[model samples]
Target chain A: MTPKVSRFLRDAAPATPCLVVDVDRVAENYGRLKAAMPLARIYYAVKANPAAPILGRLVDMQSCFDAASLEEVRLCLDAGARPEDISFGNTVKKESAIQAAYAAGVRMFAFDSEPELRKLARSAPGAKVYCRILVGNVGAEWPLSKKFGCEVEMARDLMVMARDLGLDPYGISFHVGSQQTRTAAYEAAIARVAMLFTDLKDAGINLRMANLGGGYPVRYRAEVPEIDAFGAAIMGAMVEHFGNALPEILIEPGRFIVGDAGVLSAEVVLVSRKEQDDPVRWVYLDIGRFGGLAETEGEAIKYAFRTPHDGGAEGPVTIAGPTCDSTDTLYEKSNYRLPLALDCGDRVELLSTGAYVTTYASQGFNGFAPLAEHYI
Target chain B: MTPKVSRFLRDAAPATPCLVVDVDRVAENYGRLKAAMPLARIYYAVKANPAAPILGRLVDMQSCFDAASLEEVRLCLDAGARPEDISFGNTVKKESAIQAAYAAGVRMFAFDSEPELRKLARSAPGAKVYCRILVGNVGAEWPLSKKFGCEVEMARDLMVMARDLGLDPYGISFHVGSQQTRTAAYEAAIARVAMLFTDLKDAGINLRMANLGGGYPVRYRAEVPEIDAFGAAIMGAMVEHFGNALPEILIEPGRFIVGDAGVLSAEVVLVSRKEQDDPVRWVYLDIGRFGGLAETEGEAIKYAFRTPHDGGAEGPVTIAGPTCDSTDTLYEKSNYRLPLALDCGDRVELLSTGAYVTTYASQGFNGFAPLAEHYI
Candidate 1:
């Protein structure tokens, strides 16, 4: 076991199936990002974890926030973040939420559609708004897929419309995608943004900022580049494309900052073989899809798991969450392997689960409580 | 618009993105099931909704419950259901949950593995237990796969082991699958149970009950056979296979009991074409997968939608929930069509959504609250 897991097991272990977030790791991650991208302002995405302690740690680091909803904005505000330091990042929002965010002193918001722009005009007039442009999500694990951003032409129209509606078209934003692994994807998305900036300038809309929305990949089972590599690429791209006219760079990093900070200690509920001769062992854990870890959707994102007998002879294993729902199975087709001696009550630590797990947990599905979160 | 939609709009138009359940329809559904299957005991699956009002209505009708957890048992008990009338239906359960259920006077439980059987033997000693046999789920919309049930030989061993552990091996149970459409699936599963019963009897264990676990189909976009057809098929299979020595029949229906009784009123958040010439309109609703309606997993279950302009010329539309998550898109690939005139603020009612929507909702993802549920 790693020292972090050992410390968690010794000092702060809650009941099994609980998320234990190490605040120290979060601070290290924040420091790394800040050191790498001194020119870029970090707006920590609150939707990733929304844990108050994590937010407070970011607040202590003098970090800004990218809030998705009124509740997230409130969470950041409660965590001591100034209103000017937070950006309402979700483009599609309820009118009431926009009003509530505006009322709470938030001035920066993101919008993509005319309807949302209209809603912003009504509720958040003169707010510094950013139009999210659709850049294809080719290399990202969690693709946004036309959900948030609009086409560049539509974005141009929306930017002009924002100005006409009396909202400041302050910047342009685009998500390369969540858990974006390829640095080339950033280069491509930045190129698209650069082209858009030129087009908007020709249209008499001088964008003041460029929000490089979150998609900074974190290492799980696969290797990822250091935060410095990403910062260098982004910085190099801005210099090559904009030269002396570089827009103020802002980033909304969700998974990159918190992903490695959390560890989920889950206990094996049962260990059984389907058939006597079957080689595969099915290890059911106390936590599953509904128990937070919804990111295991389609079993696409493979999390690094640490068992006590990690170096022992390994055998094929199917991991499942402790729920009646069949879709709660975490690894069946993924060729997941674990120690053969692992039995019921054996604890396993899921690494890099700090982001997206707790916030996406369903409320008491099949009588299973949401995954308990504990900050260390 | 359908008459139901018109009535809902005219009489009880709730806030957008709310679940409205018709108690009268629930009663009618219960009556229909009772009328069709007079011999089988109706154990309403609490995991389906677990709404207090729905449970109260079931209690008034003297319906038994198939609780998945201790909380579900408590919900039923709070709804005035007798402990003797409730069965702990989930096979994989926490030891504490089993103890809690036993303490709450629930004697009937289900198990499929030796580990679980051992847990039950310790916590719920002398309780009436059933071994779930793996039945193929070829025709199920939501296939259970291998998440549940054991093979016949392992089940036989587990049954004998249950008796050895001093727990009553009360019965054999198998689920054809959830949302099973083919009547032959039930017939085949019942035949398998019959052979198991004969084998168990030969082993000197007299099984006292046969639980044809819930998979009763409900009308969505497709036509489904009435409850009577399923009842007739089950009865015929039992009679044909077991003759006069039939065990007591029990069914735990979740979706069938509640699916048709609920309607979801979701307002259009936006209607937009990604490309100006694109033919398909993307209709965003205030509700999405996290908002409930997670049954739309894989787009396998298609819900019938009724717009105010239902009879107007229709165009292919992509349905999405009002969340920033890309996976929240409901029907992008399912040939879902809506009225071309459907615009922002236009209300659309999702029919037959009563059973699994409310209880499965995420706590709050992307700042959106859980789908508000109202019973009329």
Candidate 2:
């Protein structure tokens, strides 16, 4: 099915199989996040595709980083982020990784247990420790609550221990889960985590800020809860819990700020037929499971496949990536309307793949290069 | 759940996250396949994983290759395979890729469309064509018959055209599907495609083989069909259909021959306490999404987490890969009976990942190194 008309076609557009980022939209997203939580310091989660140019733009927007690894910390630093602006969000602290972060001048760190605290104390003794408490329950849909973060009682113990050991327990943190759709889940977690601050205060440990660990759902597909609503709910919950006594809020939003602004565009080099009830069209494109994992992690990102000109006709096609594996499929059911019949050497754009589009999934299969990023 | 007392003490071994292929077993598998298919030529699907060593081993075993791309053709050549031994199995051909394959002297090609036939006619006019037909109604669970082949009616037309144009339509091919569990599907498809050979001979365009394409299931988990039974059923069906007049038989056995023979091995770098669940041992191993996509596809590859030495008590734990994405999981519900308590810097091994294990779904996220492949 073709689009009624094509308004986006340009003769000079580079070939497909490239990652395109809407610079204006990403910057606007950054500004929106800042405006929503004006008092909160934002850390761009580099764990989502940490493309240098994208990180550079985030740096330009005055965003800090929530880095999960030493390499992520280095990536932000390479993109001109100050080491002091990055928080090592990964709670599992290996001595070398912590040492690398410390060497990179990263001041803030997250600790989920006494063992991690001991590692930090032994290695980067002066690093600012943020007690990562296991905050909310993300039910069976995604049970990320099972990963890292200390329980409330254990968090209180660690906070008390940190204060007693003359270590800086500057903040408290909680990551609800990634790709979170429910704003209520976030609000409840915020209210629950805020209580930990009051408990620590009762124990005479004054915390500086509450790191509401990221999971601001990006508009991957469907009506993603508005970032403003999430920010307001968390901010409202913080005010209701502690009023003026609340610490400065710090939020880490990775996917929300970047996910929808990116598009992976590739050309169909060959269209093969498969045996089915109908002759299924196998549109062979450059991007596959490795390049666009968001597609495989269904519901994480919504995939809309379009040819360069929407003015083409539509069909039911199974988009196969270039990888030879039969499982390497981008979309099982793609219903699209384009300007003309798409044949070999036609480009298709996969929308809303910005945040986690690139950085990690570069498999050099077929000697096909990784998508060279282009900022529009 | 620790495996019962065995020499492979969950930890006191090479490491966890290591792909340890029992070379002897893989060799036995090769021997078994050769024994089972006395008349059929085994075309090892190199697209499963183009590891040079693995290719070399197959070459040593006199296995022909089902090359999907120019690079795979080159890999096979580099592994010491002769040019004539490789079949360019991909039906959708790019001009450059076609030129490369021709230059590399790939003689057997699978053709699906008239346009593809024209390309072959112009580029490599003398090459033998395999009239690729879709296994329509072949009740294989994955029925690839939907994507890469032509309708029987269209295949008949192509065969007539090829003969008229002096092209050698030497055989008919139909891939039931990859990891196919049903033997009846292969039998039915064989019966159908074999009729095409007879039809061609009746028309005086005699062809030699009817390829029952690769769909032989590989053991990912314990629930897969018995290979011996499957091979026997396929042989039985071939005899039942084309018996005395049966030309040559060709089967592309990619996963079955190599899948269980390989294991993706890596080591645990960090272990963290998850919020609500058990300790999520963040085994930051060297392997990633690229090594093999079986884990993501929900294929039944058994994962066994082990270490170098008996360190502590044995228990089941969740294994997370080094990739930053929340979906980067190896075994979702595997019970690794660690002989000792596994901590940071411990190793874990994923068992039976030989086929499509290396570079098939690699995402070099966070700069995690590729799974280092080793041979026994």
Candidate 3:
């Protein structure tokens, strides 16, 4: 078990099936990111956790925010973040939300399509808008498909359209993808952004800022390169591509800033064998896929489990959530193993579960309340 | 478009991404079930959709409730359902929840394992308990896998254990699976239950009730047999297996009771082609996996979509939720087609969505509100 989790388990004594976020660890993760990319301004992605305390901590640290909606902008503002420090990162947005965010003083927004640009033009005139260009999301654990960004030609046209619509064609942005691990992915995306910047300039729209959208990875079950390594690769690519004309760099990181700082302490609800001779023990917990662990999408993201009896004999186990729903099974095909001695009422701490949990929780599915969150 | 959806769209100009439930249709579906299965007591599965209005309507129809948690028990009770009329159907439950349900005057419960039996014995002594036996879930649209039910041998032992622990082993139950279309699956499950009933009787335990757990299929993309067809099959099997000594029959139907009674009216947020040569138009809706409609798991359950321009030229399209997450894509691989003329702000109503859409909603992922439900 990591010392962070051990300390949390010892000190917090949190209710079962609750998330315990360590604000100290969050500060440390922030420090690490700042040290890695000193020149780049950090915009904390609010979608990852959106817990009030986490947002408050980030605001206290003077961190800018990447707000996806008007509600998110309100959350950051409530947490003491200035509207000028918030960027509406979602390219596809409701016109009402655009007007609301603009009314609340948010000036930076992202758009990838002409319709979205038109909505922005009507709702928030003269706002600093960025065009997201599509790039390969190779080697990312959660590779974002073609959902947000547009092609380079379309992005160039969109930038010109933004200028024509009386909006600030302020920047170019591209997401390598969420939980991205490869340094080359950054190099390729930065190169694409450089190409887009030159093309937009040729179209008489000189962008002033480049938003390197969030994709920075966090260490889960697998080993990820150090934060410094990602910084070095990004800095090297920016210098190689843009030389003296590098736009002001900005990063919107979600997981890397908060993934490691949180730990989930869920209780073992039941440990039984469906068949008497079955080798794998089914370990059911109070929390499941709907209870904030949706990131276990297809069991692709394996969370490290720690039990009180960690030193005991280990045996193969299929972990499941407590819901009656069949899809709530956490890890069955992954050959997950746990201490043989684990039983009902025993606590199992899932590590690195800080990000993408709370916000994904269902509203009392099967009569069970949403996962409780606690910050220490 | 279905007449129900058209009427709803015409009368209720509800906000985008809202669920419109037809209570009259709910009454009709309930009446159909009653006419089909006259002998079986209807225990409305509250997990399908725990909306207050639906529960109140069910309560007025004199429907028994299959509550999965204490909160559900409370919901049913609040909706005017007698505590005696509610069954705690979820086998895996927290001891505190069991205690709360018992204290709330619930005497009927279900158990599958020894640990659970012990918990029930302590929290709900003398309660009417049913042992769920594992059965094949073939030909089920939503096969439950092994998340619920125990093998026959283990269930037999657990029943005897329940008797020893001062809990009443009052019945045997088995779910063929949710959305079960095959009549043979019910026959096979009933035969196994009959054998268990005889075995328990010989062991000096007279099981007085039999629960044919919820698995009734709903018509979505394909046609389903009428409620009478399922009732006839179940009645024929019960009479064939148990002869004249039939126990009190109980059923917990969730989707079948409410599935067809509701329509989801989601607005088109965006309709764009991701790539230049891509023929598939990506249609984004305000509601996605997080905003309910999680039943689209693995793209297994295909929901029928209807637009205002249903008679217009149809084109291949991929449906997606409005969340920033890539996994929120709903129907990329499902060969979904929509009206080619559909654009942003146009409404597309998802049929047969009343049962599983509302309660399964995530709590505002990506800063989007949960899907609103309006009863008409």
Candidate 4:
């Protein structure tokens, strides 16, 4: 945990099952990322954690935003962001959302299909549009594959169609997937985008931007390559493919900017075993999958935990949330182990949970209050 | 869809991506369950969908409630349910919640571990307590295994310990699983509970209740055993084991009581394909896994769809929610097919979604509003 967050927990002692975020850590992460890639403009993906404090800090950093919905665009605006600094990033958007966002003075938008392109043409007239192309999600824990971006041929035609339909064909975008590990994945995706840029140029549409859609990794029970490595790989590929005439580069990072900035403090509600001699104890926490640990589904995004009994002898454990549903069990097959001294009512902190935790909480599943959040 | 909901939709034309529940269908389902199991008391599982309209109607039907949290206990009370008729059924609970529920005059509680049982004994003095036993969840589409319940021997000992702690050792409870498809699953669980009942009786605890927890099926995309068949199998097993000395049989049903009573109406946001020659279309809906169809995780609950052009030519489709996260993709490997004519802005209905949909909605992921709800 960050010293600021730990200090807050020691003094405030908030109620069980709450998220405590160190705001300064967010600024530090942003600074480090900027140092890693000096030329690339950062667009903070607001869908990760749209808390006002975090957004306000990013606004002070002069960072632009990538909004997944119109409401997110308004959140950026509400946080003192200029309208020109936001992009409507999701390809699948309602026409009304497009109209509202356009009316709000956000000019940049994303589209992968002809229908979405048409919606943008009708609602967001004269807006800058980017075509997303499909890419392989190699070595990603959470792959963002076929649910999104279209094929290269379709994207090539769409950018040309965008120019003909009174829109600015501004860029090409691709994501190697969320929680992407290997830096080579980004290089491969960039090569694909470069090929698309060449094809679109031949089709009479010279796309001037390259959006390296975010898949940056965070430390979560495993070692990942440093951000400097990704920065080096991206710059190397740009020179190799674009002959030093690199397009205006944009990076939409969410997890890397704020993942390690927060910790989820939850209490052990109960500790039990199925049998007297069973080796694995089921550690039930007040916070669960429905309680905002939604990323723990599939036991992917494994989170490192801190307990009061750290450094003590530990045993095999099946961690679970207090919810009655079997799927609420967080880590059964992931070889999770907990301190044997742990018991009910002991406070435990799930580390590096700043991103994608708060917003995914159910409104009130099983009548448990929505997870409480505190920004330091 | 129920004629009541469909007629309401036709007349009212409520906004898309909302739920339309027929309160009358809840009453009819309650009536059928009561008729099928005349000897047992029905405790509506409030965690399924805690909308006030559904709870108030179930209260008017003289239905008892199984609450998973203390807030749910208050909800039942607000809906006119007597404290004496309600049971706090979740195995994992905080001590403060136990104290509050006991102060609210709730007398029946459930526990599976010594820690939770001790908390209940201290907080809800002299309350009737039941121990949950681990049971196989074979043949269940959504299994409730290895999470909440304890070993049978452990349950027998806990019941004896309850009597020693000055609490009433009331009963034994087990859930076969949610969306249970086989009658034999219930029979197998009952056989386990019957053995525990016999062991507790031998220890002079005189366990008088057999809490056959809810696992009754709701027909989604596939045919499930009739409710009448479940009633026959349960009663037949009770007779075979107890031999005219059947204990107070109590059934806690949630999904079966309400799953088929509501339909989720959502609008198609976008429809596109990865490649020009790819036969499978990706249908993006305004409502998705985070929106409330959380049962779609792992494609466990296959919801049947009703569209405007159901009779048209059908083709394979990959259905997904309109979120940037790839995990929001719902059905890809399940062979989901839709009308070839389906396109953006078309309305579709997901059937048998009344039970668990509303409570599972994320507060607001990606700046989208929580799923809207309506009752008639």
Q: Report the number of the highest-DockQ candidate.
A: 4
lDDT (10s digit) by residue, model 3, range B101-208: 999999999878778889999989999999888899998998887888889988888888899999889999999888999889999999999999888888889999
* Docking quality level of the chain pair in candidate 1: medium
Cα displacement (angstroms), candidate 2, residue A312, comes to: 4.7
lDDT of 2 at B235: 86
DockQ metric for all predictions: 0.64, 0.33, 0.66, 0.87
Give residue A4's error in model 2 in angstroms: 24
Q: Model 4, range B1-376, lDDT digits (tens) per residue?
A: 8889989888988898999999999999999999999999999999999999999999999999999999999999999999999999999999999999999999999999999989988999899999998888888888875998898888988888899999999999999899888888778888888888887778997889999999799998888888887898889999988888899999999998889999999999999888778999999999999999899999999999999999999999999997888899889999999999998999999999998888888988998888999989
A195-218: candidate 2 lDDT, tens digit per residue:
787888899888888888777776
User: Residue-wise lDDT of candidate 1 within A230-320, one digit each (tens)?
Assistant: 8898889888888899899999898989998888889988888776677988888999888888889888678999988989999998899
lDDT: worst 10-residue window of model 1 chain B:
B1-10
Better by lDDT, candidate 4 or 1: 4
- Top candidate on lDDT is 4
User: TM-score of chain A for candidate 4?
Assistant: 0.99
lDDT of each: 0.86, 0.69, 0.87, 0.92
Model 3 chain B weakest lDDT span, ten residues long: B1-10
lDDT of 1 by residue, B269-343 (tens): 788776657798888889888888788879988999988898999999889988778888899888999998998
How far out, in Å, is residue A51 in model 3? 2.1
Candidate achieving higher lDDT, 1 or 2 = 1
Which wins on TM-score, candidate 1 or candidate 2? 1
